[model samples]
Target: MTHIDSATAGPVSGAVRGDGLDARLVVERGSFRLDVALTAAPGDVVALLGPNGAGKTTALRALAGLTPLTGGHLRLDGDSLDRTPPESRPVGVVFQDYLLFPHLSALDNVAFGPRCQGASKADARAQAAQWLDRMGLADHAGARPRRLSGGQAQRVALARALATRPRLLLLDEPLAALDARTRLDVRAQLRRHLTEFEAVAVLVTHDPLDAMVLADRLVVIEHGRIVQEGAPSDIARHPRTDYIAQLVGLNLYKGRAEGHAVRLDAGPAITTTEDLTGPAFVAFPPGAVTLYRDRPTGSSARNLWRCEVAGLETHGDQIRADLTGELPLAADLTTVAAAELDLQPGATVWATVKAAQTHAYPA
Candidate 1:
């Protein structure tokens, strides 16, 4: 299959133009401008992950030519698609809500793309049947959009997109519309389909787990900018920003690193095994924290801070305590320990963490 390979027209400065889809999209509105550069090779599954309104959808729209770029360039398969209309682009998009036509049956919906491209009615139906059969929805080909379940509708949307034989596929929160129970099953099925796609695929999702499971690479965006891009495991182990740290469930602090100790800007200091200078970030999991009702005597822990219980909640089988004081952090403890210590909001406690438990890296 001939897919988007490479292009050099209106080359973007510092843009990656190796193979497959290469784009440097810039959209300018009053008081807000989204400028993001994206590149994906053939058979690569990339996920655009970020908080809401971080321009993920805008980037996807720009790639499909649904949204015009005020600056920068978009190229696919050695062809400059900067001025191409949305329908002409060799791209397919699966919207968050599926966006299936309510009046159309599953077979008709899947056949619509081929029919629009001048395929005969009989041929379109035949091709559509093949796609529906692949999606395991041939039994429901006569069912209308409203009659199908959430997972079935999602599969139909995917079939419709794939029926066009697009070189680039874009999925925006593909499982967001389904309930939690249905999302699990649909996610696994979607992962299987994505693995089989032999073209550039980009999926937009805010859920970290979904992004990790679906995409080979993750592009984290915030405030219309790409902050971090790497493998999911690397991003989880070393978060560059507090937003990412929070999303990955870690307590992150910025400080000036000394030999084996770092003095926090928040008034407390922490000791770590990492030896560095200048600015640094110290991160530790909530489970690393140990709380004591009274100051523990002769404790070997290098980091100790007096904090008040700001809140308490159940996290899995353990209780997570939100603390605030000299150093704000979260502590997770067993329910038995919480009951024994009489932990509650507004109660003062001493939190300790060993130097070995903290991971410090240059910021």
Candidate 2:
């Protein structure tokens, strides 16, 4: 495997030079084809989010020149790196496992990158010391990978990547290895470091919280293509696909809209506040759904469906019930309510949602 290191190389193509990162990554393996176009300005942190087998890793590998692109182009800081070797490209990667050499101390590990780039041993060590100090790991400089904590090792890895002064930085699940308590502290610290970075940073992560917290913009990929891209707030408010909706914790349905009603493709019609024609999407938060053991007569809710509890799980102090029936959806209720309703798999219930709670947008 080619490790990320700094190298001086000329542009391989006559393509117009552009600032930051501009690339259309295309990779083909067997029947899987990944085609993703990514552009980021200097100092921008973009997060690539997707489910398993969604090609998130493939796209990251393509950008780092680890997985060769069968098509598309790669450019960074006005230089075309389409044909640049992995060791020759000015790209730095912080792998999921941190990938620190067990035999090297934290300081030596950080210095390794600059040393490989031909910096003098003294200069490389000096630079590494500064980075360790910046990462607040100066106290652990002499510690080996086994001695450092998860968060400390992650910072060391990041310091090592940044030591090369690469124009494009790639972080693969940088916080995935940390424990919940450690992840909270490290995530905030990582955000600060990313903000101070002057180069383009691309992070691939499966955790929605990681993406929403660390990235300035989010690019959601599904089955090898970008399903949606936008600010975290915007994407959270309006999701275009089921994958995105689920990620943001919203119940989404696609249908044809006529006035205040949308006839869903899944054999149901939803009432929304928006009036429109043609294909549309209606979405509501799981909390907006109310479940009842017996159907209530003369309820004010505009939408009601007979549903059966498919499963139940605890979601942040609330009981999240997955229902399958008239309209497959999820509902969040207090534990007390769950106990009162006797919610369990195979239990029949009535689900209700007020029209005001549903938002509809053009598809």
Candidate 3:
């Protein structure tokens, strides 16, 4: 119960740290190093969120002693944990792939942790059964990892990690393997379970939606350093990094505003809603755009630009196009629409956004 507390049940910020998992992590390997500090309270689900190679995984690995630290310290419930080995650390890790034994049934996998912690086999199985039931996996106890679905396997993984009764629980991209449909269901269930846990739980993910939905607070890292950290809602409202802004699907532009419109140094001039007279940030959602390869004769969209298609990636049934020219921006278009337009990299295109779609605020 040291990692999170019931007193913080109302509302709290990222500044809220408890007498649970306190970490000053510094791990160096050649040019790559991770220097980060954070704390998570009992029942507090803190997410380590960032893009790939942003040191999110490195930070988690360092805390569990899976990776050696060149310097810094870690403590759990006020006890120093500098020299603790991975096995000895009071930590339970649920890897992204679950890492469940394929041959063992769900019951055996959940029991393995407690058994390793010196509980009798019968006692371990008993405790494991209880954990499985709590995870809503009682019916799947006899199912093997291969037999279970991704969401079911994840629940088993959680039950196994929690069975050890570790003070600090760690999960790395726990729901990344599931399909979007399954992810939503699993994330809601996981949130409920995390809320009930009376200890610190830290989860790592690159998906902004997962981090926002699953954790009380977020600590974002990039290039081995903490870039931004705050409550999910706060960080979403005020993202300091362009990366964070882009991840949240905002059309962020660093430009100067003379009147109602702002001119992006890289590409386009946008008519904004905010009345600014100097340098400002103009942001719009990707959904706000209406695209046409040819310039419109009399379109309502006031902000128009000539851009070249840079790339395209699939998001569900939609194709997200990356454009370059007046400005580099990502646009979400349906796959059928993209095919109909004959869109490809290096193709010239015209993009437009309504003034209402353009939101301008102080930088």
Candidate 4:
């Protein structure tokens, strides 16, 4: 669907690598547990993105061997790691809070990993210095963890993780520590480093923008399970659940299809461009929906669902109307349009959207 030239669309430089990480981790803590299956190809950076308490951290912890699995398996670079311990696995982790030792200098902190792996103190510090140089922290290598800025500490944490030459890199809320202004700068730097890493890297984040910009694919977890997993842009445009829909601020409905439209058995008859004639989904941004108190006469829009307003709320400068009738849908209207219609909860309304504005795909 893009106009990009074919020559510009060639594959990333390198031979095709095998699936970098193939894992099915089942972890339990108290009454809460996580059962997740995830796979990432070599050179791929997948993001575990979800809301708070959605098991994003739990899943990442499982992968890094920080949390023991009740069952399921883990494989990395085609090798089985069924019994690998956290200290033994070729995995590197950057914890949410950095977890850098406050008493250690940035160089010593990075040196710890290689040192624990049996490198001599001199050898470890030499490798650590090289990593700090690679991370552009050569001058700050002697600085203690508490003295470094947040972004600087994060870079040191990353350098420490990479010191061991890990096959699977795990990052938990990597940018959640920085200020908003620093986040932008660190994000760009992180993206460049991720692109250069030849092995698989996984990061968990709650920020949608971070997931979209830093990952090749996003694995969305809800209720301890993966609710959606796909390229970031795809998930953004077609989310499946109310949480994801609201997270992305789009209207989504599932129903039966016939020709260019899908009739929601529970809601509305929505039209779309998909050619399939069976079960499908029709989705659009709330902003694409138009609401009117009275149905327009001879309107060119082919789909119209009459409904009663259930609730109304302000979304930034726009108003979002929650409707209940033939179909439940969220429609956005300008303040002026809402005032003109005198829209309120329990008010009767007609929602219309053209087929061209609607997107339909397989559910």
Candidate 5:
């Protein structure tokens, strides 16, 4: 629960630190291509966040040198590593499934890295023991990978990666193997360990909560490209694309701005207080949307859209209504209000939002 600086703390995100990771990976196959640029500073944890098939794994593989890059540069601490092989690069990777050797004991699994790096058996085992102890797995050192629990195996994988003394750490869906119950605990432990790591670390995950909790900065990728990159809070507050907006649970629209009104590309105009020009984005919380059975006569709300309820679902204590028509948006209402309005799928409703509730920013 220690507080880490929430600034835009990555190489491509904000200001670049001289001694950090600077990479651009491009891979071209027969039909699909991936081109991603990433940067992070020492002591910074960056998460590659996106939906499936968004090239998160491809970028991670390129960074770990497991996949060859068709173009672009890879640098760590001012040293170029574009041509380095996977085994030769000063990098460590923890795969989604942990990828531990089933036959190897936890101690030996961790020791294998240092041993491969030319350390003596005794030295390697000693370092491995220390790492296990740091990971709170000292007593489980003799357990085989199959005998270890999901969280324990994850710690072992992380310990093995760190045992090599890597300058850059790459984790591909590090917690994807664990169940929901274990993921929470393991995520916390991983966060603490990552905070202690002085080297640059990049983790790939499709879970927004995981990315927000484990990383200081998030680089959201879609279709083999970076769509947005910034501090987690900033990204959450002002998502640029529909994918990002959906991930953050905000209603977003793109439009052309004139004074306080934005004419959306999809034929809906939203009124806001922002004095922006040219292309812009308008976003508001689902909770800010008010659902009415009939259009209000004296309501002060400026933005009103006649929408049909396409779907309804319970979200915690609130009911989420998915609407379509003039403006496609999501609205959150209390269970009591939903019952009073007799809300259901295919029901017609009027949605309105106060101008002050809508946030407009340059797109």
Candidate 6:
């Protein structure tokens, strides 16, 4: 639960005159190799998002100097940290578990960083008190980790990390330890804290909502490589990968485009509003799809497919049907509409999506 301050180490060489993070992280582990180039300005919060075994954590560990880079370089606020040891890098890490010392009070936990940085005991305690106050936990300074609530403990951990005055902040699933209700409140608090941070912050998480809410930009990794990187809104609107489309609740398909029609790789052609050629991607939300018991007579939908209900599940207040047949996709409808259509496993259904509902972009 104790962390050594980077300030205790001598100055490193190769200090440049940059302002923020510039890293080309490359780490190889047997068959797995991660190569991702990342850059961010001061005050920017970037999220590393990926599924399990996708190298999100590996990238984070490399930045924190916990994992040695097999290639590439890491620079933060102008200093090259590629050769810096974990304790000598000007970085702060807020781990998933918070990792507060059980026997120490909240004040001592936050003071640990400054104390290691060569501050006097009184000065470190005073600095820790100020950080605890900024985190709105001044009253809990005397309490042990066991006495603090989940949200409070998270704040203490964040305060501990920030007390080091690090140029680069690394957070690994900071909200994953909390319950749903606690996560909502703590996420907002963390967002505010990140906004007030003057340096660069990098967060690693699998939750799309967390990445969207906390990060200014998103870097999505898959198979140890960056498949996509952009603003959350852009990524959500034009997901380039199936994993991203599913993460954003859209059904995606790749196809060859000709004007408004796209010939999908799955053997069906879908109508879209865009008029582009060559390879492209088509994406539509589940709610944009309408289901019919039988082929609707004289329907105006440009894209229609003969599908069978593969499965059904409750999604919020609606029924989400997983369909497979001529075109595999997902459809969300009201529970009443699902009952009216007699939706169930193996039920035959016709799915229709208007051209205007689908978004198409170059692959």
Score every model by TM-score: 0.91, 0.94, 0.83, 0.84, 0.93, 0.94
Each candidate: RMSD: 4.7, 5.0, 5.2, 6.5, 4.5, 5.5
lDDT of 6 by residue, 223-325 (tens): 8877787789999999998899999999999999999999998779999999999999999999999999999888899999999999999998999999999
Q: Count of backbone clashes for each model?
A: 3, 0, 6, 2, 0, 0
Instruction: Give the alpha-carbon lDDT of every model.
Output: 0.86, 0.89, 0.83, 0.82, 0.88, 0.89
lDDT of 6 at 223: 81
**Over the stretch 150-214, how does candidate 1's per-residue lDDT look in tens digits?**
99999999999999999899998899999999999999999999999988899988798898899
Ten-residue region with minimum lDDT total, candidate 4 = 1-10
Better of 2 and 5 by TM-score: 2
Runs of candidate 4 with Cα error greater than 4 angstroms are 1-19, 28-33, 51-53, 307-319, 333-349
- For candidate 2, write residues 254-301 as lDDT tens digits: 999999999998779999899989999999999999988899897899
lDDT of 3 by residue, 1-363 (tens): 001111112222332444787778787777776778877767788888777788888788887888877877788888888898899988999999999999899999999999999999999999999999999999999999999999999999999999999899999999989998999999999999988888888989888998999898888787777777778887776676788888777868878887898887776678877778787878777777777879888898888888999999987678889888887778888887899889999999988888987777666
lDDT of 1: 0.86
TM-score of 1: 0.91
What lDDT does candidate 6 reach at residue 64? 93
Better of 4 and 5 by TM-score: 5
Query: What's the true lDDT of residue 102 in model 6?
Result: 92
Per-residue alpha-carbon lDDT of candidate 4 for residues 147-183, written as tens digits (9 for 90 to 100): 9999999999999999998999999889998999999
